[model samples]
Target: QTYKFRLYPNKKQEEQLLWTLEKCRLVYNDMLAGLNKEEKPNRLKLQSMLPELKKQYPELKGVYSKVLQYEVYKLFSNLKGLGELKKKGRKVGRLRFKGKGWFKTFTYNQSGFKLIDTNKRLKSLHLSKIGDNISIRVHRKIDGNIKQITIKKHCSGKWYANMVTERNNKKHDKKISSVIGIDKGIKYFLTDTEGRRIENSQFLKNSLKKLRREQRRLSRKKKKSSNYNKQRIKVARVHEQITNHRIDFLHKLSRSYIDNYDMIAVENLNIKNLVRNHHLARSISDVSWSAFDNMLSYKAENANKTVVRVDPKGTSQEYKYGRDLDRDYNASLNILERGLASLPQGLRKVTPVEIEPLQKLETISASLIIETGSLFQNHK
Candidate 1:
């Protein structure tokens, strides 16, 4: 995970966020002006200049706002790169300066960060302006120090607190005793070489009917009415529940693979092209193949395992029932059943590494011309 820890922000916390954001915005604007004048815009000097700035620009309104000492500078440091505003340079999403309302948002530095506290081996988190008794859940014990903290508010209006830490990297081996090829399809989420068929959870499919019903219920209520707002939240919570279920399923499934397999080989799906097919697009998203594979990688890395991605061009098509390739794709998914059928019983936990030339795999016969995709993009 990129970061850890949950933020518990109350009403008072919300005010503080707005305050900090506003001040950070001012800091960035002044710096930009200083740079234009060939003046140094250092943080230390900026701290000292705040009083004079407030004195000169009374309209900037100094006395009414909360003082800066209450919050630390590390957590919500001024936006630097794209944050500094690119000239013409096109960008998506609205770019707005941090306003006074953002002071409740806290910044963190390598210092404001801290060790995670566990019920087992004790560790503590230290906040610069705050106390050290912040409670955090320790899932994996590791050697590390907190690097930074970022607290954000999600689109769903929920507060999230993240603690970025420097942790040790894990190591795993390249296991090649066995190889399994997986084909992810719309009908079935996955069909593996071992004949372990995983059914599609189809969370979106299952939730649509109920979602539409709730949506209609929401529409019936008057706009801007209290009842409408209340019903909207209810509808949102339902969708959230379905998403939670899918996320949990992906996490568990990926973990199971990490714990059991030393290597996992999967097709690189071109999501862009796949989504163009309206008929199967919804089904493809429901399975969330990309997310599953991504989670599998880091989790496997942590366990000292490997993830082998083979060219997926002819995986399903090359092996028609009862047919053999004139020249087998360097490795064919269809023939996977034939290839591993003779493996020892105790050797199911490991898989082949990415040791073969992908060009060799690309030479196999495909039912149709396969376009360049994510799989090709990742080829070594």
Candidate 2:
């Protein structure tokens, strides 16, 4: 679970990366549409269709369909999983869009694209217009052989490539090197059973001054003007910096803990309650509580250790109020009618952030997961 999130492009390189995404989208959509109209669409059909489809969309055909070509077929195979779900006719609010601060993108091997560094050369990928062997800056030397590379432009105008690699998890075959319990809290990131404390990164605190200043600058810019666009990029950069700093800080620190003791215990936090306060919304999101849990799970499992999260019921990690240790799992009364009325209206409006791309589930290689209890409970 030692996944690295690195920013890998200089400006000129990033510009062309956008072309790769556009080319991929065009090819993917074309193939998808073509497959939809077929009586029996199969691999050879897709392989044959590429040249014709590209001939029609000369722009896509020009890029030289290599890996992008195979993926079109692979995507068709994967689509079988979703075909049933689509029968319910779910809402699709918008057609897909890629490029700056937008969707995640992939281009295949036949395209002249590859990630690069001062030292090592990664696998070459080619897309139509972008040519083959497009260079990628290797921000850090990766651990495993590169498997797949996806170039993404964040909503913040920052360029990033997520490369997935398969690597042996670090071994931590130490005897219960040490046992520790953790109390997770806002004031303290983690307080262990052995009384060791890890501070909250609080990256937002250090960033707020600059963030507010840049945001204020953005506010003063005339709307939709060159100046405003310029200010928007500036704002995006500030947010990007904050994000990078937080993620880097978390990854390093979590690895540090994993590299140490075995049998690490922690209090299972109720984050929904914490997020109720609007003032803490940004900070909580910045903390990425779910991400932390995800990290701890993978890191511990890969290292052959136990990560036990105890009930928060009698926890006293971050507070000095209300019964000294009891976490009051309070509930507000709601009539039966109110509960039933809330179903369609309230639930439908609550849009959950799409989690389809979370590597946490897919990356856990031979890891053990132990669940203490459910977050949502109903009493009789």
TM-score of each model, paired residue for residue: 0.62, 0.62
Candidate 2 residue runs with Cα over 4 Å from true position: 1-15, 28-51, 64-104, 107-141, 155-158, 168-174, 222-224, 269-280, 311-380
**Candidates' lDDT values, in order?**
0.54, 0.54
How many steric overlaps are in each model, in order? 22, 17
- Give the Å error, residue 366, model 1: 31
User: Highest TM-score, which number?
Assistant: 2
TM-score, structure 1 vs. true: 0.62
Off by over 4 Å in 1: 3-5, 18-109, 115-126, 129-143, 155-157, 170-175, 220-229, 320-380
The whole-model C-alpha lDDT of candidate 1 against the native structure comes to: 0.54
- Cα error, candidate 1, residue 283 (Å): 2.2
Q: Which tens-of-lDDT digit does each residue in 1-380 have in candidate 2? A: 23334454546656666665667766666666766677776767777777777667777654545756755755666666566556768543322323343435563442344443445543333334554454444545577766555556776665555666677766643444344344455555554433334456677777899999999999999997999988998998888887776665565556655766555555566787878889987677766766777777887876786666655553433333223322211100011112222333322221212111111111111011112111111100
lDDT of 1 at 147: 63
- Candidate 1 per-residue lDDT over residues 1-380, each given as its tens digit: 45544544456655555444565556545544543453433555555565676676554452222234223133124324444455557473433443443433445645544554555433455444444544444455444665666655543455556766676875434434545556666555665544444557688888999989999999999987999878887787778777767776777656655665555677666887988999878888877889988888877666766565655676655534434422233234443443343344454443233323222222211111112222212222
